[model samples]
Target: MERKIKIFMIDDDPDDREFFQIALDMTGIRYTLKTAESAVEALNIFPEFLELPDYIFLDLNMPLISGIQFLQIFRESADLNKVPIIIFSTSSYHKDIEDTKALGASHFLSKTSDIDRLSEVVVSILKGNDLPFILT
Candidate 1:
């Protein structure tokens, strides 16, 4: 049997999270989804997760602690820094993408209206494809 991919998503919007869950369910990808309303919540749970998630989808804009701040914190930590972190945000600004990539995000994906595109992006990330952002 193929191993199920473990995915952790740090998104503030409940609707977006639900949409992603529905999309994943429809795609039939063997994945485990975990949601965090804030980066603090994610950081709190990071240690307890049995293993590092195969993919981490993070939102750029959020209250309290932003995704960029989370990335900085994660980068400072040895244990969390090794895992693949993807900036899954609504922002499509060139500067935002560049800044995130420079800060060690594996990929910068804009929130898309198409579920098919989202699924494809997820699949590509899981398959270890050479994405357009930093893979560190």
Candidate 2:
């Protein structure tokens, strides 16, 4: 039996959070979404998690602690070794993609204003597919 997919997202933009949640809901997959506006806030609350999220959608930009910084810290946790980390960003830079992949990110997803496309991405990820943000 499939369990409810738990997703954790860290983004400072409220609109981004709301849009992503809507897209995720549209996938018709049972899920639970927990969001944090800042990496610092996310880190603080992370220890309280009773269960690990199926995936983590992380943004590259944020105040204080950038997403890249957070990724480094997050990867150090031996317990989270198997949890896939997906990079969520408006940036489609090749360097960003290469760097994150090297740092252990499973895939990169661009932040699109289109909800349908977002939903498609959500579905792809749930189906164990990748939507890589290639610079080309």
Candidate 3:
């Protein structure tokens, strides 16, 4: 049996986190999801997890320690350096996209409200299917 894919999402908004969970459920893929409401919270808790997630979705905007800051920290951690991290954000700013890529983000995707599209993208990512991204 194939092991379920593990995904971690760090976002501040409760509504956004709910929407993302709902979208993941709609994808019909076997996945285990762990969420952190803030980047600081994630940093504190991630080290406790025995198995690192296969992928990490980070919100660009957050209260303390923004996604970029978290990315920098994550990069420094030997255990997390190789995990694929996707910058999931509402901002489509060119600078944000470029910065995320330069900082070692595997992909940059604008947060979508459409559940179907979100599900599609999640499924594609799990299956190692390529989805077009601005920076990579």
Candidate 4:
């Protein structure tokens, strides 16, 4: 039997979260999605969710701690390093993408216009499919 894909989304916006859910739903991919509105919330849940996620979609711009900061913290935690992290952000800055890749991000995707693109990207990542970015 195929293992179900587990996903964790660290994004502050409710609309974006909803968009992701809809995107995933349209894909028909079996997954368990957990959402955290802030880095603190994500960190708080990390202990219990250790190595549970197959993929993590994080937003770059957030309150308090940014995605890069969160990635730094997550990387320092040995248990969290095993899960693949993808920066799903609106900013397409080369510096940000390169920085996250250097920090060990699996991929960096700029936020797309709709759920279809998001779903496509997520499906590709889950299938170990590679796509082009600033660093890929």
Candidate 5:
């Protein structure tokens, strides 16, 4: 049997987290989704992961330890650096996109309120058709 894709997402908003879960559930791809409300929480639980995530979706704005800061720390870690990190945020500012790309983010996906759109993007990433950057 094919192994389930392990996906980790860090976002402070509970509603946004729920939206992501719904999007993933809509996809045909088999996946296991784990989430942390903040970067600090994710870091605290990182060592306990039996299997590291195949992809990590991060939000730009949060109460503490913003996504960019987390990305810097994440890339500094030898073990975590290689994992694909996707900047999933509501911000569409050029600075945000460029900053994340420079920091080694695999892709920058805009957070859309449309569930169908979000699901489609999730499917693309899982299917390996992820473009350089995606805005939805």
Candidate 6:
């Protein structure tokens, strides 16, 4: 049996987290989704996990430590560096995309209101497509 994908999502908004869960559920792919409302909470729980996440989705805006800050710290850890990090944010700013890409983010995707589109993007990423952004 194939192993299920492990996904970690860090976003302050509960609604956005719920949306992501819904999107993942729609994909029909085998995955375990874990969420943290803030970077601090994620960091606190990260080291406790027996198996690290296969992929991490980060939101740009948050109270205290932002996603970019979290990414820097996350990438600095030797054990966490190899995991693919995707910047999943509501911001459509070019600078945000450029910054995260320079910091080693695997992909940057704008948060979509459409759940189906989000599901498609998740499927593409899981399939190992090299595209930086998933065009609707």
Query: Which candidate number maximizes TM-score?
Result: 5
* Candidate RMSDs in order: 2.5, 1.9, 1.7, 1.9, 1.0, 1.3
lDDT of 2 by residue, 68-112 (tens): 889999999899867888888998877888888888988788888
If candidate 2 were superposed on the true structure by all CA atoms, what would the RMSD be?
1.9
- Candidate 1 stretches with Cα past 4 Å from truth are 134-136
Most accurate candidate by lDDT:
5
lDDT (CA) per prediction: 0.85, 0.87, 0.87, 0.85, 0.90, 0.89
Off by over 4 Å in 5: none
Q: What is the lDDT of residue 116 in candidate 6?
A: 90
C-alpha TM-score for every candidate? 0.91, 0.92, 0.94, 0.91, 0.95, 0.95
Write candidate 4's Cα lDDT for 44-102 as tens digits. 89878655798999998999999999999999977778889989888888789889999
Question: What digit string (tens of lDDT, one per residue) describes model 3 on residues 71-127?
Answer: 998998777898999898998888888888888988887788788888888778778
lDDT of the structure predicted as candidate 6: 0.89
Clashes of 1: 0
Poorest 10 consecutive residues of model 6 by lDDT? 127-136
Indicate whether candidate 5 or candidate 6 has the larger TM-score. 5
Q: Which ten residues in a row have the lowest lDDT in candidate 4?
A: 127-136
